[model samples]
Target chain A: MTADMTTDMIADPSGTRSPGEVLSWSRATLEPALRGAVDTLPGSLRHLVGYHFGWWDERGGPTGSAAGSGKAIRPALVFLASRAVGGDPLAAMPAAVAVELVHNFSLVHDDVMDGDHTRRHRRTVWSVFGVGPAILAGDALVTLAMDVLDGHPATSVLAAAVQDLLSGQSADLEFEDRNDVVLPECVRMAQQKTGALLGCSCAIGASFAGAEPVRVEHLRGFGEQLGLAFQVVDDLLGIWGDPAVTGKPVFSDLENRKKSLPVVAALTSGTPAGELLAERYATADEDLPGLAALIDEAGGRAWAHQQADALVEAALCDLRLADPAPGPAAELTGIADLVTHRDS
Target chain B: MTADMTTDMIADPSGTRSPGEVLSWSRATLEPALRGAVDTLPGSLRHLVGYHFGWWDERGGPTGSAAGSGKAIRPALVFLASRAVGGDPLAAMPAAVAVELVHNFSLVHDDVMDGDHTRRHRRTVWSVFGVGPAILAGDALVTLAMDVLDGHPATSVLAAAVQDLLSGQSADLEFEDRNDVVLPECVRMAQQKTGALLGCSCAIGASFAGAEPVRVEHLRGFGEQLGLAFQVVDDLLGIWGDPAVTGKPVFSDLENRKKSLPVVAALTSGTPAGELLAERYATADEDLPGLAALIDEAGGRAWAHQQADALVEAALCDLRLADPAPGPAAELTGIADLVTHRDS
Candidate 1:
């Protein structure tokens, strides 16, 4: 899995590249391949999915700016893991598309639930298309994800992958209203929400390539760990990163009184600052600056960062164990670095 | 088809039938089967899906009023069609549940879009659970629906069914925004929105039983025609049925500007009444009396009923050509009659 050999990675001929450069390169290559599948949609539907992906203008024309399509991190991990397991990354493209579609479906619906107006620096699907069309679009995407997976290698394996995605999504939803959500609960949610898709990506890739059972299991473990690490890093950035880089307002989660991993950890941390932060969060909409201050003072931020570091280390260790093909494995290693270190 | 044989047509021998009696009976029979396939979900997720189905209340206790699961029309169609094709209906239960789950998933999302507060005479999932969780619930249902099909039948057939579902849903979303909808387009929308699922239901049922291609084609045709007729009749009811009996506002389609089939037909009718109906429909609001009078005076309601009658006749004609197995075919005939005639 050598990143240097990948066409997507090759787009940056400049010898010097930042971690962000790696993320963008991985995403850039993956986007068109994904768009290829979406382009196959009926013309009426093709534009709608395209709009949701932020590739189309409001009137359903192409927008030209390809920057806002979210980091295609999950798909890249999938492609990398596929090559790592000795499979062609292209063979895993459908599975990669499936996982990404599922992720976007969640985002569209989440925006509606949170009453959010903007995503990727523009109006959300619900905001632009209205709630009915937005819900239908999300529904269509979910069905499309499964439809994409239908061409996967075997019935049994595909069935298991579908089950994993559903179970993960179910757990993530359950955690939303729960005021008592704990670190363990959040970890479990991570497994379902992120880990399941990652695991499926690897498993489907391995199955498509006809890898042995031992290799499939090993790749699955690598992806599960990597997915958890990815979520941990995302949670960290959600609270502590710059608004400009993340394309989100500072302390946005606190404003929504969301119960992310860090907030949950602080609530049960048992320190005075932790207690104060918990009290502030309990009120839902206390002063945003004061809440951020309490969370930082409580050491919640540090604890979250430390946890992310540990998980990333664990993920990398598993990646080594999977022993991927040279080209894809190298890409996976770089992605693991990018995932854990991203400021946004 | 014998009215006595179809479950819905039978008077409750137990004398316990209620508003959601069919829904309750179907759930009791279906849940165990679904649980058998999805055995690995962690406890919390298992509970979340459970509550979504109304087997449990919001706090995770059994909801005493568990009767209102849904109409179960699609699943019952699957089972009945399987039987009518000389296959074991029990073997097709997975397919039945899968189709029903997808149907319910669409309904939950649809309710949110339409801003309808009640379903089955109870609060809709989105209204009760909030939009985010409802979206997740809908997503989980779709994922599970695919999984259910993935395990029992031919993988290729199941995959095709999922693809059709997605394509259909995508068209449904597009239709909502287009004001120039006409009869042909409405028929095409009906095929995508309703006929496709029913066709898949029959196709999967045949697949589950490993029926011959000829038999599968016949059942598919039967399901498609029956579904089209069902949608046509529903359009009539939407405009003309008594609000009290329908559990929906009278001329709900006019009020919401739903672009229903009769409305499309009326728009194309070019009669003086048709022209007036169109004018009022375009600006539908609380002037319900005026709108209702316009539709009745313009012959839109009568025209809708006639169109439904024609479709029902055509559907029955198709069923006759199929020569379905006597017992289940008889049941489907009766079910079709019930569906087409019901005010609701």
Candidate 2:
């Protein structure tokens, strides 16, 4: 949470400095272009977007720019992937900005669809402006993203990614209503919703640098697998991470009855614990801790963690195909470590 | 309403074939690509889109493809303008499909934002599939539009138009909250919301054909002016046209308390009828026909019709600059006539 990256704000138990610190370095360079592009939004949308970024308080009061949690992660992929491929990070700015804008547009509309009110401890755009304005603002951001991708062949990559993102989101929403969500279905949904954009970011950076198509596809594969791995690890933290460190209650995802990877895994495992957990879910919110334990006992947690590790390994293989520089490649390895191993 | 394009369905008062007939001609070529693009939407979205396009009823009952009113007009502009500029209309099919996709994207989101339940005499996507899916489908369509526009420099033009479209929609939602709306402000909003995509369609057709910048600009101006003129005429009809022709309860726009062009003009005129109408708007929806009369008495209808005439005149001047082929040029003139003079 600290502006100064040297502070051990994001640390591993073994005490090595996590490469997650790369986010702040990229954020500093990416901030001006992001703000300038957001400023171009018409009328009150400038304020709504400002409010979204936490640069301003909900009532149109300026709060200066606050880093949106995990927002910098995708853009970090765009920048570091550029550098890893021997491309200038600054030249990849438009791709980076467009990726971030695309991410925010999804978030804005997602909140409206889910009726979510707050994120990063602030009111959502739909919560502040009416639904209509927020929807239009999201539309404007998509327009801006397309505009930024202009003159670059990477626009096709971004568009395909966006379609994939929406497809995943649609499936996720559909999954919420059915108790029949299987593990592979959940994983594919996660990849579609989250991995596609990450994949696009990786490919678009190389694309803007005029990299060979084969190398670009390799980077895309690496980022996509990395994204799926990251989501699995995040779902893990939502359940079992220490509240004192993570600041979220234990079994957070379970309490909300989210059909996340682990939960879906346990529910469809055909084990005694899985059956009990599924039955309990249909009832009230009682015994959330027991449900969490059932998922763990049913091997859901271990299964998810193992999948994350395997995906990360596969992602590393793809990263090798891209033939990235050793130094930046090492940073990517650190990022993978940071994603899969962060205790907090 | 009928399959026969030769029907006098959208007849001008004088016994002549309406240029709305041109939509059928353009639809012949554009429909296949348009359906193929929409089919790329994942899973249930294909069905939802099918419903939105009137290919299915609410229960997924197959309906033969029905013409979506006004949906074809923008694509028609794209195809006709391409031919008008001496480009082969067949070569402009991608631009035509892209424009229609963009238009439908707006329509889907606009219905969700506006909270309307029905469009095209059928259930809306949100009402049937749910809001989340509808919103996601709209996002998917926008992505599809960008994908279709790929490898074309007209992509930038489409992006800019989408931005302008969003800007207009935002201003419109904002204007609904404020009591003061001026004539010029309303006109600009109309231009932004309606004119932008229309202008985009016109220019994209030429851009696809590798038209010079000056010709593209001229065609864009013509389309934009024509859009403004169309809105003016439509607004005039909302106030004074016979309900039997327009298919609405008398004063439907006024009854819904919409801040439409004529209503805004009459509200801001500073005349006695304007003051009376303004006071009436603050109260209940009683006497909507009377409110419509006040708009007429305040010179709102006459002024709107006059502005429409002027804009069409100005539009024709720009159309001449494009130096369109005579046959296609006549079609454009007929379209202008049909839009301005339609009773329905």
Candidate 3:
């Protein structure tokens, strides 16, 4: 494990550990737990799931098998929430598995719908296997995830989680068509697209702990706020983070013409940046580069960063309301801050 | 509704009801159930689902009413099986809704994959709404079905049902690429594609009734057998049924060069009839008329009819093992006979 993967930090700004240390530790603990679940899929489907999980090469062979797997941040948050409520993180394992699977399933399908050839520096599932097989694989994984929830969690909790995932996905799809999405709408979209799953994850963990309904609600709120903050940070990174650190090409969102939180915030600015970005989105694909420059000149980047900062502050407020016990909660809050504040 | 929609005995002799009647009843029950659930979707997604469900016209406006909704036979089986097993069918309503939604979700995606333009004499969801929106609608419905399952059934039962749906879908997709599918393999594929969901429906009903595991297994077996019989009848209709009765043009299997049961059986035939049929299957798309004649000469229709008859007998044998007490069980038996023996 990396030396960076075993440190702790307090929630307060005055906390001592570096952000990288907390992030690394969260990654260290979450990867194996999520990977173990992925490895447990039936033989017929395991190879496809593994390919999506970044553990297998195209021909059902093993990839390098190193642990640059997905960030695992979502699963970490789930486990952390469970522990914060004095529940065993192990008890929340199935939920962690479910949420991660749903996330990956969406990724596989979204890549197809967007016609994105590459994901995580490898050929997307649809690109390598053809659209039909890729679609089947994604559908299978999603079904399997719901099935896993059958094992230990309460049916109500699992149902709620699945509902949240669907609602979020529905909102995300809706956002694609609108020409004028505002900050509040984007925030709501982020909640549905990102917050719903996170909230469900936390709620599931609390259920396993046998926490009271009020407590579960509190944890859900904390998760929702955290997710919103995470998405806002993601939007900022889409526009401004260095390619090497973010592992995405420069101007990637601009090229896709994604109306992310920052772009939406800038559009709310009702200034040149918002107008330029909207004009670029309406323009033909061939003219994107010049339009992207106009957007940058209009302060889209700075406005997006400001939005991220505000969301992170709001998330901290929700975390305070949860009033979790000191150790795990502090560590989780620190990690949330790291996620909301980081460049990558 | 047309008189044809109410009753047409010779056209559906083995079936308990005519296609028009069966289709209409299914529409009546499922439309209200589905509308209740879809009402929860956001404006954009709600509209998309509405259009796909045949509640809207080509221009995205409401059609003033729903028409041509799919036959909700799967949901009926779930409810019928529940009642047959002495369970309160009302308790299984959520699951009944779930199975039907999943079935429709598959139908939407399958139509796209198969490049089918019309279903029930109406343009397909993809044909009207564009592929992107249709895909989102399918994904939304699938997730919603999973959510619906969360409400009423036990977690384990719902999970298992979801897994069965996915497994069945996987096998069906696998069948598309397989040209060497034999009779037993076809039976197995049918079991996976159709039998599994039927089995789940039965098992879920048993769960509601607090039935013994052994009894549940028997009911599941009955459902599985019935499902296979149902598919075999469908295969027969694909090749030789009357257009007015089936709603599809005759000899569609020949036009699509589909590997239906009769085609598989004839391929096994070493007689002149078999040779002629094989030659027809090998012919180009432009040779459909001659191919249909060749298939008829090969006794493919008779062979398929015989196979379907045998499957129906087997299904009845399995049902007897369940020993379902009078009313609902008898009605279910009657329905099975209709599915297997119906002309359309």
Whole-model lDDT per candidate: 0.67, 0.80, 0.67
* Model 2 superposed RMSD (Cα): 4.8
- Candidates sorted by lDDT, best first: 2, 1, 3
Cα deviation at B235, candidate 1, in Å, is 2.4
**Among all windows of ten consecutive residues in candidate 1 chain B, which has the lowest summed lDDT?**
B10-19
Q: Is the docking of candidate 3 incorrect, acceptable, medium or high quality?
A: acceptable
Best by DockQ: 2
List candidate 3 stretches off by more than 4 Å. Answer: A1-44, A66-68, A151-178, A240-250, A285-289, A342-344, B1-32, B56-66, B151-158, B175-179, B241-258, B266-284, B294-300
lDDT of 3 by residue, B252-343 (tens): 76666666666767765666877766655665746666665666667766776777677667767766777775655666676777787678
Ranking 1 against 3 by DockQ, winner: 1
Locate the minimum summed-lDDT window of 10 residues in model 2 chain B: B7-16
Question: Candidate 2's error at B154, in angstroms?
Answer: 1.5
Compared with the true structure, what per-residue lDDT tens digits does model 3 show for residues A1-344? 24623333322223334445544555555567666765655454566778887787878777886432567666767767777777876677677777777778777777766677766767788887767667766776676667666545354465455555555555555566778777787777777777777777777777777777777788888777777777777767666766666656776776676777766766666776667667667666556456556556667667666666676677666666666766666766677778776774
CA displacement after TM-score superposition, residue A176 of candidate 1 (Å): 5.7
